[model samples]
Target: MRTEANRRKINRLYILGAGASYALTQGQTESLVAPLDIQFCQRIKDLQQRTRPKWVAAAARRVEKEYLHHVDFQITGLEELIRQQISDYEFIAAIHPRRTRGKRTKEEYLNDLNHLAAYLLSRARARDQSLLEKWLEKYLKGTEKRATRNRIITFNYDTLIDNVLLNWHSPQHVYFDNIWSSSTKSPTRLADRYPLLLKLHGSINWRCSEEEYAKLFNSAVTTDESKTTTYNTKDCHYIDKMWINNRVCTPEEQETPLIIPPLPQKPITSIAIFRYLWTYAYEYLYEARNIVIAGYSLPPEPPRVSRRLQLLREWSHEQVKQVFT
Candidate 1:
């Protein structure tokens, strides 16, 4: 149990990035579990030996041919490259025709791009589950008293945090923007708890119906269980298996993964859920007395995320006494 004085001093916030997960998964195997862009293409190729789909293999080849060889500048990762391509042709048709796009508009390619990226990320999460679970158990658990006061903001889309939290804390203790509450009781104030997690980039576990997506923009608190489902990354494999089997996908099966693609301009403004997440994050940042950034390099190109950090710095300039990286 935490004393009043200890609770008051627990205003620490942690910011996590891909490197945080990478560091945790290192040294256990010969192949890197969750790799950066430099190793992403090879990793996808390696995944091909297992159960990858034809479209995924084709996307891997495209990344190698168009991005790895042709591009002179330093590309961040495979997801960033795919996002750049999607943005470049945001309003125009592809220069070369695609067999898959025979009757579909160029805009439909965006879904294909996002699905490919999401698939790779999901596979990586599945591959590194053991090591990640160990790390979370050692660090995130056993410190429940401290956790209630500390806030976490993660840029990665993996559900590592969600998995650990669900096992360690009650559903009510962990708050996600999309997940419906299991109870109708009045919500407790977030400030009273220390280790609230905010996934700034979104999570793979999050799935919503079209109606819920529309409602997110109109309501302050969207909690309709019928319109949303939040399961672990492992559960999402059912949809992937449907794709692999080449079956007719249902609307529920085709629901979008809640990740915000790594675009130059993140879709925070256009997407209401993302906007709400940013607002929630700002509230935590405002009250943070110490900020510790782990494995997250403040990457420059993503304008919305970069801008959000800048705003946090300005908002908590006087309030934050210590910052550890």
Candidate 2:
């Protein structure tokens, strides 16, 4: 049992989705939603056309014209088509250094995905306008400076709620204990007085490697590197920064976006941090007193995700009480 649960009742647990962020847009406009999910193709196509570093714009356009040609722009069921394209070896062989002999260069696929990740990072201004906004406003007025516990589990790669919780709580208190480890379980207890936000799909602003990044970006990015934070894992050195500040980083300054794209089986889910996140999400689900889902439908396109999350189907059978969709 979570130690705090024994002493103080855990407050409502919120599960957020793209809809939550969509609700945060300047006017809650569809066009202003962060660039992921159904909007990915259109947003990436638009971004490629106008984004900076003329070479990147040209490269993105070329890749879309050639590889992504099959999907209709802005269509509702495009994810089915997207899954096909993502699995195509002909276009994305560039992701593998030795498999570089295809229609697209090794750099194009990587550039496009990172470009999309950077786009999401630029929209971090979102979390403060939704339920989180209301919750924090109410939280600050309460007498419980310590002891009360609340939590949010979000699938969004954007740092909207993550940033909000960070402002009100120490960063360490917001995660599973030792979250970087793949095998970690819940801590018997966590810190008090603030909500913890679990980002299941990973964040665009999460830690990435400096050495790997150097291969993609020009040395010029190093000038601002000193302002960033770095730490060593069991294996390599990583810096807690993604691309530099921009909707689309210039080709020379491009650093890959760290967010996981929605593939049936994400190539990176094997990494420990993400596994640890999902494990915690499962624990929090059973522990919460109340659960509310916002802007998430648990789409079935990513077959592996749907299969792993078969437990969600139990909700329809009333396994958990008071679920608000």
Candidate 3:
């Protein structure tokens, strides 16, 4: 039996950033994956060395020709250069006529960029003794002691947090846009459950129909076993393996994993799933009493993300009792 006082306690919201994922490396040089902004050229070069895909090679050449030609290496990183290219391409597309030949379109560039990012992130294997799991346990224990309600909002696309939560509790407890239930039972909305986890930037494991993207955002639960899809990061690895083995041959097979790349201006409002995530995040931030920001620098370059964070800070300023950064 729960007490009335417990139900009335303040909610705690945690904000995670790229640095949060990087910190999980625990100073291990071999297992560490470089952040978006660091080692921009080297990452591309390494990817080129690993794979012989024409698109990957073409993407590298484009990056070198367009960005590395004149920019100061000390000042701008890969992420910044990529953002600038995307922005410039967008501007050109909006004003001038679409060019069919000589250069790759903005969409093609973005596709290559996303594929490269996914490949890089997927290669990062967790160590035998996980430090992330231990850290999360202690963090959760402390948060539960002070707050009645707790939720996580992560900007990073990695599945480290997802792995921790799923391992800690039942699959139903960890909600990413979709709900989960046993094969015998119907799924339920994440809001119906306590302690929700929202991925703001999306995840590597998430995939949906490119043609029917909005359909993927539907919250209606399914009871039919055939229709019920298992939401696990490992499932993503399986899909990747199938693709590599030539088992995935059809167009539908190739476009299964739908991931949103790390860009300055994300199409959150345009996409149904992202829009819902942002709305959910805003609601939580507005009602939260404590906001714990860990390892997130809140970079000023990304307008969409920065604007939302600014609004969250403003909305929770009066109600928030404490802010831990």
Candidate 4:
């Protein structure tokens, strides 16, 4: 049994999923109802419709005919096909030699599926960042206990939480994500010891350039678009650039970093940077006294991640207390 002292002395953390914010607004949830798989299948159809170089078209047609069609060729079907291709390619081949291609490699199919999934999920309804701000305000207010420290770990690409933490540029709200900072100063040791936000899956507002990438595995923000963004060893650097920097105050310049278009495709492996961040977040969760799970279904597709958390739960003896502690 966990002693009251142990639980009371622990830290507090929250794990959020894309669904968490969406849940706050039914309208937002409805907007995300467009299944990613369906959209991806449509994209493939769109690609087939568009006039491409003869070589490109031919390769696509070959992939579609030999690979896509065999998997029932529906948007919903792509995920399973990708999974099977990776873990059971040989078994799949025995079932259908023509589609599998005698020399077909599972990794290639998996890659295709990843790109497809990323595109599809990208289409999920735009979350109401405003609503998120409200919820966060309430949550944070309830979290004012002096002895308790609070932090958040999120896998989402949205910035609703970012806006809330920074208090709409209000001086009162001094919190920062530090995901995109280019500061040369040593990292704040307080960040290491205190509860701090960790973008385990990366955020949408982060940006970087090639130079920053070379100097630091990743740096947070840079004035130079070509300069690489900084990243801590904890996250994968593969997240989308959050916001573009525009020195020009003109409206045209402000619109340069429009969010990437959503197209149905396979899942992109999170940047290795995300992997590290995620691992750290998990460690924090196990140690934290309170945990609030929001907006995630805990999919089994990513077995490693779910497994890690499960192991933590077991190790904690299911004795982890809630944040109210």
Candidate 5:
């Protein structure tokens, strides 16, 4: 709950990342560790060692300097065996240093990435819904002034925010679409009065469809009603169904495009749902006055997001306030 004065202030925007929700969800600090890509690189080096590749030795040394010192320096530190497979002497060194000798296979590496991604996202989603539900109750119950004029803009692709707001009986209140046409001015329609949640990168629950928006709305609402899991708490269930057909495929099975990765790419094929989301993210930024950012690293877009954030910073002049809180 906010103070009466703060509640009366202008609409606020919230930017969240894995860390933000991870904190609320009781995620361990070690869970937030990086060196994720390095996990894959190490595996590559291990495989190269057995069947000496042209670049194995050099790559191993470079990887050691780049990352191994902090984690595994013993094998990498071996003056002559840096590129060698598990020689008898090197094997002794590996055991002494408590480092695994074989690098994980490609498939194994992919599984590791997926496991990390899933754990991080699970923690984030759980926390995201908890916070959003608190604010949403305020909006629905008309508890505060700021709650009446609030919207959320996040880089996450999780369905936590979507499920909470829609469950609050105001699906129209949350705006997920991105309208790109310059001529299309912002509408002061009934939905505009409701709180908006623009997921900039995209979300797993949403799909590109040829179906009418009305049908989609009805279907979503129906699904919302069917979900018996509680929201806004660690006890809440994970909405794995949100992902394309409830699919959490391995790297090889991830043939279709994705929106939840560390980076995002424009789908060459037409994905109407994604187009709508990307458009609305821009719109949310355009209309926002105060943006609250938390744990998000602003990545550059060709002519959007990053540049817009830069311009916002330059022109803010105390007009817009970005707080990590």
Candidate 6:
């Protein structure tokens, strides 16, 4: 049987949503805050402009080449568009009639889906520095060593928190899911010693399937296990996991990074790593002394013609809150 001390090592858990990334630029000059779903349509329109951020222009070129007709890309509102497009492409492919006037082909629609994903990623990447660093400095009195009691689980795709916590040993010992194991290892010096920075909705810097990665970016595919762990179709690697200083595609001529895409139209249970990550989160939650949820809301949808006082609601009110150490 396990001792109580072993179970209590991880004392705090943080759950982050988009609002967390959005909060990063709360008081910066001309800093780009992470985009909420609604900002996408305008961002998409911005993609058409000749003068744009390097990352934006790079992703826009890809969209211009392979976008669907509706990538005529305008959603009067963003959240509704996110909900509509998040429906599985396979589902769209199955029901879409042949030669439909306005609809696109299966391949084309899939391309557009990825186009949106890439665009979202670029917006987050365009920021020069992470404001999260200062946020931490305000509370963290001094430099921390390798071991920490705090664990993080972020829903946003931005790497703000990743960049913040990734320096303990370069890739630092942060453990979320073992790319090598289907089962999560119990907390031990060899495997589970590091803080768990779980990216529940995947991350901006994670890449899966080397073959697919090469194919998407038109690179030469090689199975050189000498560099990376043996290629696994079932798992993903952080961009830095295999190579140093390489990013998944940047406008500054950075490498093309891969993401599992945000809250896809399909269930994430199909992905093995996601399964393990969520299980890890649940296990941590069960033993956590405190949980801090940084950013989430049920904010009102905007641009309504009526300027009347509307009730402000929250999705988590039906949930619970006890934020503290």
> TM-score of each candidate?
0.64, 0.66, 0.67, 0.49, 0.43, 0.61
Clashing pairs in 3: 207-258
Clashing pairs in 1: 147-195, 148-193, 148-194, 148-195, 149-194, 149-195, 150-194
lDDT string for model 5 (110-140, tens) is 2333332333343333534466577657643
lDDT of each: 0.52, 0.51, 0.53, 0.42, 0.40, 0.46
Instruction: Point out where model 6 deviates above 4 Å.
Output: 1-8, 26-31, 51-73, 76-79, 86-96, 100-131, 134-146, 170-172, 175-190, 193-195, 210-246, 250-256, 263-265, 298-321
> What TM-score does prediction 2 earn?
0.66
Report the C-alpha displacement of residue 126, candidate 3, in angstroms.
5.3
| Model 1 CA deviation exceeding 4 Å by range | 1-10, 30-32, 45-76, 90-107, 124-147, 181-195, 210-252, 300-305
Error of 3 at 121 (Å): 1.6
Candidate 4 accuracy as TM-score: 0.49
The predictions' CA RMSDs to the true structure, in order, are: 8.8, 8.6, 8.5, 10.1, 16.2, 9.5
The segments of candidate 2 whose C-alpha lies over 4 angstroms from its true place after superposition are 1-9, 26-31, 49-59, 66-69, 73-82, 90-111, 124-132, 139-145, 175-195, 210-255, 267-269, 300-308, 311-321
- Residue 64 displacement in candidate 2 (angstroms): 1.1
lDDT of 4 at 236: 30
Clashes of 6: 5
Which residue pairs collide, candidate 6? 248-255, 248-256, 248-257, 249-255, 249-256
Error of 2 at 119 (Å): 1.3
Candidate number of the best TM-score: 3
TM-score of 1: 0.64
In candidate 5, clashing pairs total 4
For lDDT, the strongest prediction is 3
The residue-level lDDT of candidate 3 at 160 comes to 63
Candidate 2 lowest-lDDT run of ten:
228-237
- The deviation in Å at residue 156 for candidate 3 is 0.4
Over 231-304, each residue of candidate 4 has an lDDT whose tens digit, in order, gives 23232334333232212111112122112222222112233434435445555655666777776664654545
